[model samples]
Target: MSDAVDPRRASAALLALGAIGLWGTLAAISTRVTAVPPFLLTGLALLMGSLVGFKAFRHKPPPAAALALGVYGLFGFHFFLFLALRLAPPVEANLVNYLWPLLIVVLAPVIVPGIAWSTRHGIAALVGFSGAALLIASSAGSLGQGAWLGYAFALASAVIWSTYSLATRRFSHFPTGYVAWFCALSGVLALACHAIFEPSYVPKAPEWPFIAALGFGPMGLAFFLWDRALKRGDPRALGNLAYLTPLLSTLLLVLFGGGALTPLSIVAMVLILGGAILGSRK
Candidate 1:
C-alpha cells in the first residue's frame, strides 16, 4: 500500500479531534452551572442536544438496535459516572472513569476484527493514560479512599463507553444524524431519573448560557463528531488522541478559572503529546 494517508481517515481524525476538543470544554462550562443537580444538568443538556435532531427529522430514523446502542452508550456512561462520583471520592472516581481511552486502544482489535494491535499502540496508550492520570491527580490531591462499589461503577462507565464506541463500528451504516435521536431519548431518560432520584431545580437565567454551551458542545455536537470519527477513522489512533481531553480540560481551567499551571502539567503535556504522535503513525 502507498504511504499516503487515506483522505477519509484523515478527515475522520479531524472529526475525532473536534469531538475531543468539545469534550475538553465540559469541565469549564460545567463549573458555571454547578447549582444544577447532576441528573438535571444532564437532562437539560441532552435535551438541548436534541435540537440537532430537528434537522434530521425528515431522514430515516435509526433502527431500534442502533437507538438502543446509542442509549446504552450515552445514558449508561453518564449514569454510571454519576453513581461513581456520588459513591466515591470524586477525583478517584473520575480517574477510574478515564480508563475508557485505554480500553478503546486495547480493545479495538478484539472488538473490530482486522484492526491489528501493535506494541507501539500499547505503549502509546499506557503513556497517554499515565499523563492523563498525572494531570487528574495533580488537579486535586486525592483522598485515596473510595467505596469499592464506586470504583466498580467507574470501571463500568469506562467499559460501557469503550464498548459503545467500538460497537458503533458494527453499525457504521447508520447516519450520524441518528445521534440527535440518541440525545433526545437519552435526555428523557436522564430527566426521568432526576425526577425520581433527585430534587428538582430549575436552571436560573444566568446559568442558561452555560447550559446551552454544555449541550451544544460537549453533549451535542461531540457525539455526532465522535460517531462519524469512529465510523471512518482508525479507532486506535482516535483512542490515543482522546488522552488529550483531560489535559485540555485542565488547561482550560487554568486559562479561564485563574488557576496556575505547574511543572507537573508541563511534563504531562509532553507525555500525552508524544504518545498521541506515536499512535498516530501509520
Candidate 2:
C-alpha cells in the first residue's frame, strides 16, 4: 500500500505542477491580447476550452447542484477578477486576487471536514504569500487610494476561487469530464455578460492564436489537471505549490519582453520554494 500510495502522491504533485506551469504563461499570453475586451476574451477562450469536454458530452451529466457549483467557481471567479482589473491598477488588483492560495491553506479545515489546519500550515501560507507579494510588488506602483471597489472585487475573486476549489473536493464523486460542461456553461454566462454590458467587437485574425493558447492551456487543460490534482493530492500542499504561479509568470513575462527580471525575483523564488517544501511536510 505504501508503494502504491507514493506513486499516486507523486503523480498528483506532477499534475498540480503541470497545471500551475501552464498558468504561469497566463500573464505573458494576456499581454499580447490587450486589445480584446475582458469579457469577450473570457467568453471565447472558455468556449474553445469547452472542446475538451466533447468526449464527455455523452456521459451522464453530474447533478444540477454540481454543475452550479462549477459555474459558481469558474464564472464567478473570472467575473470578479475582470471587474477588479478594470477598476483598479492591474498589478495591485492581481496581487490582491492571488490571496486565493493562502485562503485555501488557511480555510481548508473549515471547508473540508476531515482536513486539519496546523500552525505550520499558517506559517507556510504566510511565507508563500510574502514571496508572492515580494514578486508582485516588484512590478506594482503606489497603491491607488480611491480604488476601494476594485480592491473589494479582487478580494471577492479570491474568496470565490478559494471556496470553489475547496467545494470541488466535496463533489469529487462527479466525473472529471463534467468540467467540460462547467467550462461550456461558464463560457455562455461570460458571453452573456459581454453582450449585456461591454461594447461588441470582433477579435482580429492575429488574436486567434493567443486566444486558442489561452483556451487550450491555462484556462482549459489546467482546470482539468487542477481537478485531478485536488482530488488525489493534499489541498494544503497544492495550495503552497500554487504560489509558484506568480514567480513562474513573472519569469515568463520577462522572457516575452513584458518586464525585466531582478535579484529580488530570485529571492522571491527561493521563499516560494521553501514555503512549498515546508508546507508539504506530513
Candidate 3:
C-alpha cells in the first residue's frame, strides 16, 4: 500500500485537473486541426510526452512490470480515447468516458483487496450516475450515428482506463517518470500502427501548433500528473475526481459559446460535484 501523505498526491490532482481542462478544449481545437488524422495527432502527442519523460529514463531503466503498465496506460487507454474523440464531441465523449470512476467504485474492492465497499461509495455512484444521465438525456436529442459510435468508444475507453488503473497498483515501486516513459512507448507503438495502416495521413503547418499543445498539455504533462496521483493516492479516491471532467467540460463549453447552461445541466453538476466530494472523504 502507498504511504499516506505522499506529496505527489497534490501534484497529481493538479495535473489531472489541468489535463481535463485541456481535454475540454480539444473539441474547439480539433476542429481546426482536421487537416491531421486523429491517429497521427495521437502518435505525435505520445512522442512529445515521451520526449518530456526522457529525463526519467536517464537515471535508470524501468522494470518489466512498469513497462507493461505504461504500455496499457499509453496505448490502450489513449488509443480508444482518441478514437472516441474522433467520433464525438469532446465534452460529450468525456462525460461518457468519465463513467470509469463508477466502474472503479464497482471494481475497487476486488482490485484493492483490503478496501471494503461502503455506503458512501453507493451514494456517490448514484449521484454521479444521476448527473450523467441528466447530461446524456439533455443532449440525447442532438446525437447522430457518429455520436452514438463515439459514446460506445468512450464507454470502452472507460473500461480500459479502469483496468489500467488497477494494473498500475502492481508496480507501486516504479518512479513516476519511468511509468510516464512506458506510457510514451505505448503511444509510440500506437503511432507506428497508424503509420503502417494510414500512410497518407499528415498534419499541415497550420495544425502543428494545436498538435504541439495537445502533446505538452494533455498528453505529456497530464499523464505525468495522473501517474503521480495513482502512485500517491488510492485509485478509488482518485476515481471520484473523474467527476471534475464533466463539470469542467460543461463550464468550458459555455465559456466557448457552445450553449447556455440549461437548468438540467446545472442540477447535474451539483449532483456530480456533491457526490464526488462525499465519496472522496475517508
Best by lDDT: 1
**Model 2 lDDT, residue 115, Cα:** 90
Q: Per TM-score, what order, best first?
A: 1, 2, 3
- Tally clashing residue pairs in candidate 2: 0
The true-versus-predicted C-alpha distance at residue 199 of model 3, in Å, is 5.9
Candidate 2 regions off by >4 Å?
1-5
lDDT of 2 by residue, 138-159 (tens): 8765555538899999999999
TM-score for candidate 1, please give it.
0.97
The residue-by-residue lDDT of candidate 3 on 161-211, one tens digit each, is 887776565456676777557756777787786877566776778878888
N/CA/C clash count, model 1: 0
Output the lDDT of residue 115, model 3. 58
Rank by lDDT, descending? 1, 2, 3
Give lDDT for model 2.
0.88
Better structure of 1 and 3 per lDDT: 1
Please tell me which model should have the higher TM-score, number 1 or number 2: 1
- Pairwise lDDT winner, candidates 1 and 2: 1
Best by TM-score: 1
Candidate 3 accuracy as lDDT: 0.72
